[model samples]
Target: MAIDLEIWWLRCLSFIIVIPFLGPHLVAIWKMLKDLLFFMVIIAIVMIGYGVASRSMVYYPTVNNFTTEAGGSIDNSFDGRSVFRQIIYPVYYFLYGDFSDELANLDSNPDAGWSIADHVLLAVHMLFVNILLFNLLIAMFTKRYEKVHQETRTIWHSQQYLFTREYFTRSPFLPPISLIYDIYCLIRMFVFFIRRNYFETPVYQHTRVFKIIPKKRDTIKEWHNFEDAYTYEYAHDEVKALKTASMKSKSGSDSDNKDDTTTDDNDLNNTTNGLKQVQRSLTRLERIVEELNVQLEGAIEKKQNPTTP
Candidate 1:
């Protein structure tokens, strides 16, 4: 009853954890599909054992054990065997007949008929499953142990004595094998200096090599206002000054034209008035000269009469 209850509890508990994490864990396992194949084969063996075990424990758990891929009908189960034989003894009997004499009591079963062939198959399955299990465990855990051990050894050896590398150079016509190490050192030094020079150069001066982004603090104010560059450079004050200068030049030209027109009109009026006065004075002089000529003729006649007397 305790075993049965435990089995039921484990089945239920697996769902509680597995239902949530099963997908991710399965993805992880699926990524390493080759490794998972070994686990799959072992699981298949365990499931087969379980099915036969169920037949013995509970009556007639489904008897379908044929796999299409393996292309062989596995003599998967037998009846009338003891509890140990139905569950576990068949596995040992198949793997090592070394256990056949030890667990012979398990062979007397009420199946189609228990045969030597069936025992050998069960033993082979068990051996394969066990080997798979051992190898998988080593692969998953062995590397971790090796890494820790290696680090400890390195520390111990490094503490005992300092390693002094004596570097030498090679020239042309020399055996390269003797100078391979020196060449490697030179290559490493070249790479180091190149990297150092690249990083130490000012990023602003060599913008093509690398772009230097201004910090958030520098860009934040400009971004918030979003000022137009053209608007800032060409202000209202500058435009207004240009317009005022243009208007003043036009006004000056108009004033000069008006003054010249007024002077021409004044000159024409003075010339017309002076021509009228000169005509009136010439007529008056003509009248005075006619009167003087008449007086002179009268005096000449009187003088001729006085001379005859």
Candidate 2:
């Protein structure tokens, strides 16, 4: 089959132009569909299983037998041999909070009434379908919706960038001009690719703002050397300051010690002065005692030699 290049080209152009506007909404829809697909798979499997179980165990024997006995063929209309009618519809009804009429009929009729197994099966089905699966699907959809809604701006901007890039690369909307422009672009790209280094280098080196910035070419060893140099300088200054402080402290302590020694010498001189004063007082008292003894001796001499009186 011959392909319509024009149709495809127009579609591509339209997609590029329109998608930027509706990107977020379209993305949200897509995400919702994806989440719902998984949710649906789980629900379908569980529902189908219950449906098959109920049909085989409960319906086939009771409803089918009843229809057969009521002047009907073996393949009765009420038999519900189709999976859609039997399993899907029943599960759908159960999930949507409409208790099945067939179940109600079976419950009312004592002959075709639910047995213990049937009751248990219905209870379990209701628990999963009505209580669990339904709520889970709602929660999953709500979470996905909120996520898509929250990230709408980011998604839209990213998609806009892509669209704008495509639009610029492509030709104008006019057929003749667009074709000419496309051909030109194609030739330009081919030439650019062939001589990539020649064309690309100038654009990259001169036109690009990012390329103007200097890139660091330091190796691990160089980085380590820089760190070591910084650390050594810092440590050297710190050690110099510490040594100066230590020397100052030593000089101050030596001066304090000299002052202490001077104070001790003064205290010793005062003690020596006090001792000399006590010695002088003792010497004067001894002289007085000696003088009194001399006077008594003279009196005794006078008594013995009394002829002059």
Candidate 3:
């Protein structure tokens, strides 16, 4: 059976294009996550330094006992003996590393008094991880999120438009049947290209998927009317009318002042300065209006011949 296959072929191409763009969007999100990993590395370096220092000074000390006044020594082996067990384990616990184990051991050492070094290291860790790294991560995420959103927003919208158009225009409902229909469409499209000279065939122009289809002639006419009304010449005429109205009002006021015979020299000077100021302002406005008209005309020309670029 002969069927129109152009729409299906175009949809296929659109789907291919849109699906690959999703990968870039995912990559952008992954790129933003790198900052978080970098932040973690910084904290890990600090933790490693503290671990090494405390392990060297406290854990593997030359004298493993404290001397007392009675000429006896007391054993100082209450803390951990290894760097992993002493420094790393304690820091991990504070940072919620081993959640189940930490929860289980929460009540086991609640009454234990921390060493002076332990207190100082804890403060440093808190300042870096909780205060500095946390805020930096939030700022990095916000910045990256906006950048990624801006980059991918157009692609995402295009994908959505294609999806909606394809779904609404699809003929077959069931997946297996739809697959068969798609295959038939592809075959028909191949035959169509075979019938026509490949190089001589008309180039396909892709219509914007998101462009709203005008259902009524009246609506299209209305759009045409709007375009005509906002043309550069029409806008220029409107500005000119406003300028003429302003000039007429100024002349009328001047004539009224002339009729008043008691007008003083100071009043005349003030009126002259005010008229000069108004003239300057009007000239500035005219220049601005002229610039706007030029820009509008250039925009219209560019829009008319979009393929020039």
Q: Which stretches of candidate 2 lie over 4 Å from their true place?
A: 1-25, 62-64, 67-81, 110-116, 162-309
Clashes of each: 7, 0, 0
Clashing pairs in 2: none
Per-residue lDDT value at 100 in model 3: 42
Show model 1 residue runs off by greater than 4 Å: 1-102, 106-113, 148-309
* Residue-level lDDT tens digits of model 2 in 1-309: 136876776465436434645677666767788888998898888888887787676656554454556665333355546657666786777776787475665566555444456777888988877888778878987888788778877888777766666656555668877888778768876676667676554332222122111223244335445655665566556556555655555555555777765665565565456546544644574566456445645555666667664
Model 1 TM-score (2 dp): 0.21
lDDT of 3 by residue, 2-106 (tens): 345866764455454455556346546666879879887887877777666644443333442335335553334456565466667656555543334432433
Q: Tell me the lDDT of model 3 at 207.
A: 39
What are the lDDT figures for the candidates, one per model?
0.47, 0.64, 0.59
**C-alpha RMSD by candidate, in order:** 46.3, 39.6, 18.3
Error of 1 at 8 (Å): 26
User: Which lDDT tens digits does candidate 1 get at residues 170-225?
Assistant: 23335666487667768866776776687774333221222223344346345323
Per-model TM-score, in order, reads 0.21, 0.43, 0.33
Q: What is the lDDT of residue 175 in candidate 3?
A: 80
